[model samples]
Target: MGIRLMALALIPMLPHLPFGQSSLSTSPLGIGTVKWGRTEGLKHAPFSLPDDATLHQLLDAAEAAGINVLDSAPAYGLAESRLGSLLASRPNRFHVFTKAGESFSHGASFWDFSESAIRRSVENSLRLLRTDRLDAVTLHCPRHDLSVLSQSDAPAVLSSLKSEGKILLSGFSVMSLDAGLLAVPHFDYLMVAWNPGFLEHQPVIEAAALARKGILLKKVLSSGSFTSVSPAESLRAARNLPGNPVILAGTINPHHLRDNIAALT
Candidate 1:
């Protein structure tokens, strides 16, 4: 896309939610940082983390392209810390969205949705991200059932954090519709998967939109499963979906970043 299209007008803004003294308004597209830190247990080809200079360039490109939201997680290896260091000198330029309830260690992933675990995770994220108040944080639900939220007090912990002003928006990320349905009432936003090849989460998206909650679409490119379709096509499909969800693209290449932004046009 041209520089003109790369302005803040490229993507439509989602409805704002009251967050303390200010409100939260996110772009229709966000840059996912899974590849920013870890490289194990991924479907993509083997790759290494970019150097500081390269990451700085990528952040520059993203900001110049009008992307103001970033998705990260504790399970994403050193993504949060690296991002924290990179963003330390440049604070409040982007809305940093992270997760709790999951962590990565010894080259394997682990899940813990207990109230204490969630609280500890959020606190660690705050220290690592170098921010006093998180723009948004959600429970990282790796399970396929509602037990992750229903059986545990993770959602309540997020609520408490929000009450204390430690975080602005709270939500959950799930892989199943049932879990998404359960999360709707508890979260101010949701991170769910949706792409052309998979539409199982359509009901969840519709329901969240109908409820007037923010929706973030993950795996929109199916983790590079867009063999038969272009990335733009997948993004366009997401834009047409309910809630005008923010499509999170996890591309590390600068060229691909621009291409993804162009796709939104």
Candidate 2:
């Protein structure tokens, strides 16, 4: 039972909606803010971090081009805060997806999954992003910790947050097929690194479709691993997946961003 097949099975029960009707599906493009406001001293610089002014211009350009989703995380130093300030007045213009589970400390990263940690992360993200609620908050790639999404208490906490309208959905960032499979049944979204270099987990795409989970394709450029393939080729390969609609390719260059957006159109 592939994901597309599963969606077909449920189609009759679902309302007759237009294809690409959802805001997410309508645009196969999203902006990743990992380099938005962070200093290069913290992490290895894959590319130069864009300045605040440059980032603001990029956001404005993305919005003008009709890109709606902006992916950020609190772990990215001042990324959430910079994004919050940029989008404070135009929050409704774009869908904001952020993450918990990871935080920055002394030029390094750490992960925590205690219930208190999860709650605090969400609260801090809300404050830093200057938004009352997030479109989605994924558990930033935790190791050996499924309790956040599997334990009996986990559902209560997430459900409470959802019920209170603090978050539209919850999910986990997966690095392996097995992890993705485990998360499929429990999450509403799945953020996975998918690119030419790592195609073995393509099955997870089908799994996401089966679960009706939104698939956020990250590392589509493979972190500069496959520089030979043009951005258009990368975008085409990602879009060719039956159920993938949103792809996030991180780049600090506005010209590159425009080039990537051109591929989607």
Candidate 3:
């Protein structure tokens, strides 16, 4: 299995992406805000929800640090709305990527891959995000097999939305490597859970890069647990693979944000 890693320096060669032409950060480190206004749900329950002022302050600090990419999802309560409100006030200041296909209700997760659901999801995101067109929308980590996702009409619906200029690209935040490999060729990008300790995604990550598909990465801190490892080690031996991934570091803590930024520059 031969692997050829692409350089992060090749981002300039990428075609004009839907992310508006703004003076955004060149670093692949992005701010992932899952705890903005969200709490009492998700993997770890009872997470603290920051006040609106604090949220605004965090965004200001992130942008001031040249981290302009944001990753959000409907499952993350208050994340989309809070980021939307802030980003609306400053258009093109951040490249916001959101998710569909999976949503939460009453602390339970639900999967909806129907064509109508996908359409509705995109529309809702556009409305909540306060953007005329979204930069990118992922499949929100569908747990079903590839056959189910492939059989669904959701992809066609997203493609239609893309043609209509409502969204720039369709992709997935994949949890299953099999699904990720099977699904990557059909979409514009895929965000895989990656960290120095997790090696399960290396093949799929490299494959996506080899296919010339865009890639985003999550779990930079192993889902917010950075104990047991040093930042320097993770930064060095962590991404020893082909191509560069925009690491979505979800942290409202300024110190963690600074450390995430250090992972790149």
Candidate 4:
């Protein structure tokens, strides 16, 4: 049976990423969990991590708004473990997307895309997330670009894990147009940055769409720096992009979540 997403609001599904390669009905707007844990290497003004109560409230608000996907990464500090504990009661209700190849330590980010490191990272993510399998696992390429896929064992490792049922999908996340385009034909889906001010990655989105691959967009708010444009308008513009990519918005406030959902609707 397909994993059904239970929500109080109606959530529209994007075109099947590659049309039946897998069975994942993704919501256009996903919740980003960076602020649920990590404190360093953030672009937004410094703020306190939400307490458990606040986090629970945020989750509730997200579910009510039909936001089913939660994007987390090891570099986000305690986000994975916290989500594991909080959602332990109903893990199947949401699609859990995470990353390998990047981690945080001493308030700094690190990279590891080797064969053994990628395998170990996938295992660790499974253990921490309290789920036997992850919905999607992407290479968290920050310092490197598409070359990382060829120079390292990340591709083969991710492919092996998918065969083993450790993850449902494998993809790439990067910050550059050339790299993003280079990665399009290499993975199942992609996570790229797009907004009104930053249109450098527009070609990447177009290419991914032509390939019929799934796409997840990050930095929709430009790290909370939307000056002239409102968040709602920005989200509306992203939805109209090629492939109808899923937009990941990182916000700790429930009110903001509602506003974002409103824009997408």
- TM-scores for all candidates? 0.91, 0.84, 0.85, 0.91
Candidates in descending TM-score order: 4, 1, 3, 2
Q: List the residue pairs that clash in candidate 3.
A: 5-242, 6-243
Q: For candidate 1, lDDT tens digit of each residue in 1-265?
A: 6674565344333433332223776667788999998999888888998888878867877776667889999999989999999998877888999999888889888888887898888889999999888989978887555887768888888889999999999978877888898778778888888888888988989888888788889998889866787898998889888775788889788778877877775
* lDDT for each residue of candidate 3 in 157-195, tens digit (9 for 90 to 100): 778988999998787778788888887777777788878
Root-mean-square deviation per candidate: 3.7, 9.3, 8.3, 4.4
The candidate maximizing TM-score is 4
Write down the lDDT of every candidate, Cα atoms only.
Answer: 0.82, 0.72, 0.71, 0.83
Answer with 1 or 3, whichever has the higher lDDT.
1
Q: Which ten residues in a row have the lowest lDDT in candidate 3?
A: 13-22
Residue lDDT tens for model 4, 166-197: 99899999767778888888788989889999
- Who wins the lDDT comparison? 4
Count backbone clashes in candidate 1: 0
Candidate 4's displacement at residue 128, Å, is: 0.8
Stretch of 10 with least lDDT, candidate 2: 12-21
